[model samples]
Target chain A: MRVLITSGGTTERIDDVRGISNFATGSLGKITAEQFLQAGHEVFLLASETAILPEAAENLTIIHITTTDSLVKNMEKLVPEVDAVVHTMAVSDYQPVFMTALSNFSDDFSKDDLLHFSAEKVRKISSNSDFQLMLLKKTPKVISYIKKWNPQVQLFGFKLLAGVSEQELVDVAQKSLVKNQADFIIANDLENITKTQHEALLISFDRIVKMHTKLEIAQSILEKAQEAYHG
Target chain B: MRVLITSGGTTERIDDVRGISNFATGSLGKITAEQFLQAGHEVFLLASETAILPEAAENLTIIHITTTDSLVKNMEKLVPEVDAVVHTMAVSDYQPVFMTALSNFSDDFSKDDLLHFSAEKVRKISSNSDFQLMLLKKTPKVISYIKKWNPQVQLFGFKLLAGVSEQELVDVAQKSLVKNQADFIIANDLENITKTQHEALLISFDRIVKMHTKLEIAQSILEKAQEAYHG
Candidate 1:
């Protein structure tokens, strides 16, 4: 089987020098990719440039990406060719609508005054700390596009919820599974994910499988993918 | 001499699960702290927990901090005891005003509807991809408080600019010096800092000293601190 895995957090550029990104280390995704390759699957790792990855392997190919847009573009090109995709990238949902120079305004300026300034005026900001305003815009849902691009590919989506109960986590994961038409969704909460060992729930239409540790989760995902492929 | 150094980028929490932060590896600050310890200065490292640090030394003490408020609190306690302070932490200038669950809103909602929703209402969001809005509020400048807390400590502030000319970098550094009453400001642009070897301009009231490489920058800073203490 050929597997496409995405790890790390997507970064949205606010300006030439700065960006908005999440705190995904890509550790789990990298682990998953390596596990699949160890199981004799060819792997294409679409990863954030900041993510720490394993050393090169004969069956592994790495594609480094920076932003959500770039990730989408690469997925469009790669998903069709792969047998399965495990998308664990912490894609940013919002981006700065406009970036203003921190040096353009004084400390005393009101929010109204700041909001009134157009993106055109904000682009001229030159100084680092000129007191600026950045309005955030919602990014399109990338996972929702995966099945659209490749209906035959086995898709495993991820749902990360902070401070949520197990029931809530499963509910959210189910919604994602239905909405994205994913074969399964891996759901976990913040409290467990931050610990050395974590647990995740794998939800498909027929059953929910709970697995402890990242390794177990990855293995279970592969098992399900194999079942789907051989069935 | 007693040296107080701050490293890593401060993180501002958006909700129970997410945060906004800058891309500071704390490599430079960690190197500077190591250099100071090697030079026999008693060191207090108030650093972000995310930063990588040198191994423990008898002359060094580490205090982990996360947010700007935490950093400020630690500074208040440690600044008076140190002879010099090197503030290299990339403190966030803004924090999200509201954090709502992503499950509450539908995908079809308009931007105007989200904008009109009060923070109180938006706080009720539940799902992960429910399309949400986050408002950003300016954070108080932490550097401006250094002199007010300790009048005698030699303060070294850092100014990082991206895609700026050398002249612009120096101007921002000078402004920081005057405004914050810093003894010196180390100025560097993104283009140079991203390279294997980088240059920084040390801007003081009397002179501007240019140094190459992270080690040279750290050494120049300590040298200036020695001049301020003994001269």
Candidate 2:
């Protein structure tokens, strides 16, 4: 079966030289993809440029992407073809809108008084003035469209919260799962996670399974996905 | 002699998870540090978190840092203690100043209409608005302070320019050398660089040497620095 796994953090470029990225290393994604590959599945890993990649294999195909738009484009094209998709990538919530020079930044600073420029045109933005204004807009949700793209494909959506309570986390994840029509939601807490131990909840339609390690999480997803896919 | 090497690209944080970083991987810095260590010299490597680092050794000490302010603090503390310094880290030119929400973004968005907040005070920014305004300010030059911190330490400053003529590149490198009072300046062009090969010009008091590889650059810096120090 063909498996699609989006791993790592997406980058939002401020310019050609500089960009904003999250803390995701894609190691967990690597493990998930490897588990599927080991179980005789064809895995396609859509990874960030800075992500920790798994070893190259005959069955594993890697596609490197930077920005959110590229991710959306790839997802829209690849979701219908794959049998299952584990959306683990930390997609950026926002993209740069426009940049302008704030020459006289005060109570009277208005859009009419601003001179905005496209960040793409400038290779390296010069920080010559008192304040260089950068405007950002929300990016589209990549996971929400997975079921719409292919309703038959089994989907696992990841929800990471900084410091929310267990009930709050599960409720939010459940809402996300319903809205996206995903089969499973991996609810993760940032505070309890460390290098050696990962605190995550495998939330399904009726029950929530607690996972203590990254390997366990990968194994659970692999086992559960195949079981549901066949039966 | 104790040699100080600043390698890698510094990350400027917009928040806890998201940050801006450059393209420098610190491979050249790693090579340079390795060269100094092989010659039986004490090496202090001040590197960014995302930088490629040299292998561990008895004489090699690594210092990891992020942001311009942290880099400055490290530089001030280490520059006075070392005998020679090779400044190669791609320091961020700008830092985040303030972030404001642009609710009714149009031809008449004003500062008073803005609700500005500190990025550090918030966990994750909600992109539910039309536009989020991020203001940035110029970062202090760490190279400019090396000499002022310790006038006796020999300095080598790196100047990276994108798609400029050789003469233009050299002229800019010379200007930077004079401004920083660096003993040597390495001029680099963005267009002529590749993963396998690097194009660099080593400019000294009276002449310039062209280098085709990262090894050549490291060797040139090592030989030149030692010769000047002992002679």
Please write out the lDDT profile of model 1 over residues B1-231, one tens digit for every residue: 999999988887755534666767788988999898888899999887668787899999999987888998999999988899999988887666564433434534443444444555321234444334454556778889988889999999998776678899888899899999999999987778654687889999888999889989999988888888887
Candidate 2 CAPRI grade:
medium
Name the TM-score of candidate 1.
0.81
- RMSD over all Cα atoms, model 1: 5.1
* Weakest ten-residue segment in model 2 chain B by summed lDDT: B111-120
Model 2: how far residue A85 lies from native, Å: 0.9
Model 1 lDDT tens row, A1-231: 999999998888765534677777888888898788888899999988768797799999999988889999999999999999999998887766665543444434443443454666321234344234455656778899989999999999998876678999889998888989999999987777644687889998889998888888888988988888788
Show the lowest summed lDDT stretch of 10 residues, model 1 chain A: A121-130
- Give interface RMSD, per candidate: 8.8, 3.3
Per-residue CA lDDT of candidate 2, range B174-212, in tens? 998899999999999877789999999999879999999
